[model samples]
Target: MMLPSKTVLVFSLFLLLNGILPSTTVAAARTTIGFTYSAVPSNSPSPEHVVAALQSLNIPAVRLLNPSPTLIRAFSYSNISLLLTVPNHLVTSFADNRSSATLWLYNNVLPFHPRARISLISVGADVITAAGDSGSDPTTAIVTAMQNLHHALIDLGIRTVSVSTTFSFINVITTAFPPSSAEFQEPVNSLVIKPVLEFLEETNSSLLMNVYPYNVYKLHGEIPISFALFEEGPFNFRDDVVTGVRYHNLFDMMVDSVIAAMAVSGYENVPLILTETGWPSNDEHMNVEESKMYAERYLQGLISHLKSGLGTPLRKEGAAETYIYQLFDDENESNSRRNNSLISDGDTMQQHWGVMYNNLTMKYNIHFDNADQISTVLGLLVPSMYFLWLLYDFRLAGILLVLVYFHSRKSEGLDTKITFITCQIFTSRFISGLLIDIDDYFCAFGAAKTHVSRSAFLVSTMLIFSVA
Candidate 1:
């Protein structure tokens, strides 16, 4: 007995759909890449222009260092998630008074929340760096502020936005070379990070850290420039002697270092978000490493690696969210002596870490939403191809459908079912073609060559049975 052709077609279609749908959806749940926007006085683009630019580039999220009411309102109905930051200057005030946090939210969040899609509230940006200026315990201020903000949100009956603070890797992590041996820097780890980690774990929030491969490369001259720029090669890798894990890029090595530090702190499950990571296109000194070419390469490579769905060596799932350091170049900051160290090639250099210009034009050609675009095109294309085929002949239509199905499955690493279904399609086509030619052969040969038709029929029967 043989299976019906309709049943075979249905079964093949079922398997084909099951195989292709999951691969297409993998990009949806992968790490989200966004941009960090800090408005510079008298130099920043308008909120409408900024929002329009982000939407034009298909960027899905943004971290606003200066979340003014007007700027926050611009993101309304944009479908771009906003990560709002409370300046370091306000941390102490927010911590000392819960009403301050509530008042801040009412001004910044209450009006445009669900419309703007506000996602996370970072209490402070690198609070440790500003500890000396504030004359207060940085750790205490961060944790208390976060608690006040969390409570404030609850009081407002809003639960969607999470609270956390950001830290710079170079300022906090003690070691990063052999990522497995990495740990948070001493007093801050004990005094500040531990309690912060505990709060994050209890609330199910993420720890935000600024991971800069360029800084790490500058600090350690032994690291090759290619490794920092995300260029893949056999020599670009660094092995963690303790964990026996091979890191192909500096970004992953730095991220895994944070993961190792978190694990040592007994809060391994808390999610990690990279609040800042980017290469500068140019600097005041015009350093060789800070060229637009290198910047473009770094941005493109980083996006590709994250979208590839290959997480860090330690944590299979990479940073839950990552924001490129900035959206527009700050001409003023390029001249400032911020974080210019003796190790930075013996010169005070601050790179312009913006992907775009103040004029709202892109500085680097990087595709932020390529995966989504490809998925969209294929979603429409597959159906359109079938519709066109339906207007043609069914035999040719079946062949085209099978070819498309095979190609899609092949991209996902084809398995036995795909190969079998492909063979079934061709075999069914072969049998149909043979049956159509049998009448011509019978008329030309007459009753004397009836065995010729019989043999062909038997062969077609065997092929159909084999497919079944």
Candidate 2:
């Protein structure tokens, strides 16, 4: 039982070398997760509470339907990334003139940037749905507004910013069952989708899509509930004749549907970010347990997908960042109004979707036992180690200075000689290659030499001219 002091010291050193020490080593890895906020219609919870709740959950981003001064101010000091959207009604006006777009950005966006961490500017909300509406030809206006806003942002030196519109049901290619052969409906694509895709491709902005697999399951009762919810079992449906891709869960099927549509429109390379996807915790027809199970499964699958760094069946290696539909269920905007059939009157489960309840208590424990140990180690070691590394590099930097001095002196003499020789050769070559006839032997010989020994001769000529 009596271990030697040296032996213990050696064991401790081994553990530290192998990264077994409980010292914090901060990794620069961060996930940009976001939630959508709607401040109008119903007085939603205050941004303070939202920010506090999201901060506690380690979420680093948020997308707002409309930018509110109160919300922006509340989150001013926080490091959360904000993606603000212009309302559907405001799109036409904003698109009509550069002045309007400039005013909007100046008033709403610029005031909060570098402080509130605003990153993306979505121009319009659900243009696909607006286009499908009976009496609204809002698509063209909205797209034009988005284009104007994008140019305005660029003019203002907002190079890292992105501008795009979000699309809902009408933009999706939902029919192809196995998921790969899915294509957008012709009428919708021709009028609204194609132009949007073209703009997104040209601007290098992501195509934001709101995909809810919960809707697919609710609408089509034939698909097994377990399969739709991503339960651990073999799916009954395995094959598709169209694209020949096998799908076990609704999420993959849904993603593949979008990919298929993008490929059809020749916009397959454009990034597709899931702007919204979440399950309602309450529904009368659907089992409450099933709703919870679906939510848990969906989040787990999403986290795994992000960590895996893989894309859907169609885009097997592309950016696949997603934003879960909401942070909390909006009772006023749920079910009938938003076509969210997952919420119901009798069950209070909709309100329970809050990872932290109204009282700010965590709904369920997110198991981070494995990460906790790593986090602890990282917290203790990274800062000290980084400083030590910096100091060590700084002390050795004199070597770089000495090397530069010698290099400069050596280059001086050779450079002048190179310059003279290179200038003479360049002048001779130019005269032969351009002014002299191809029939002349000297011109033909010069052209042949230039073509055959192009790379080597150019390098030599440049060095000679520079030295001379």
The number of the candidate with the highest lDDT is 1
The residue-level lDDT of candidate 2 at 185 comes to 84
**Model 2, stretches more than 4 Å misplaced?**
1-32, 39-45, 131-134, 169-171, 283-290, 334-354, 364-468
Model 1 TM-score on a 0 to 1 scale: 0.72
TM-score (all chains, Cα) for each model: 0.72, 0.66
**Across residues 167-234, which tens digit of lDDT does each residue of candidate 1 receive?**
88888888897988889999999989999999999988999998888878887888998998889776
Q: Per-model C-alpha lDDT, please?
A: 0.77, 0.61
- Considering every candidate listed, which one attains the maximal TM-score? 1
Q: Estimate the overall C-alpha local distance difference test score of candidate 2.
A: 0.61
Positional deviation of 49 in candidate 2, in angstroms? 3.9
- The TM-score that candidate 2 achieves is 0.66
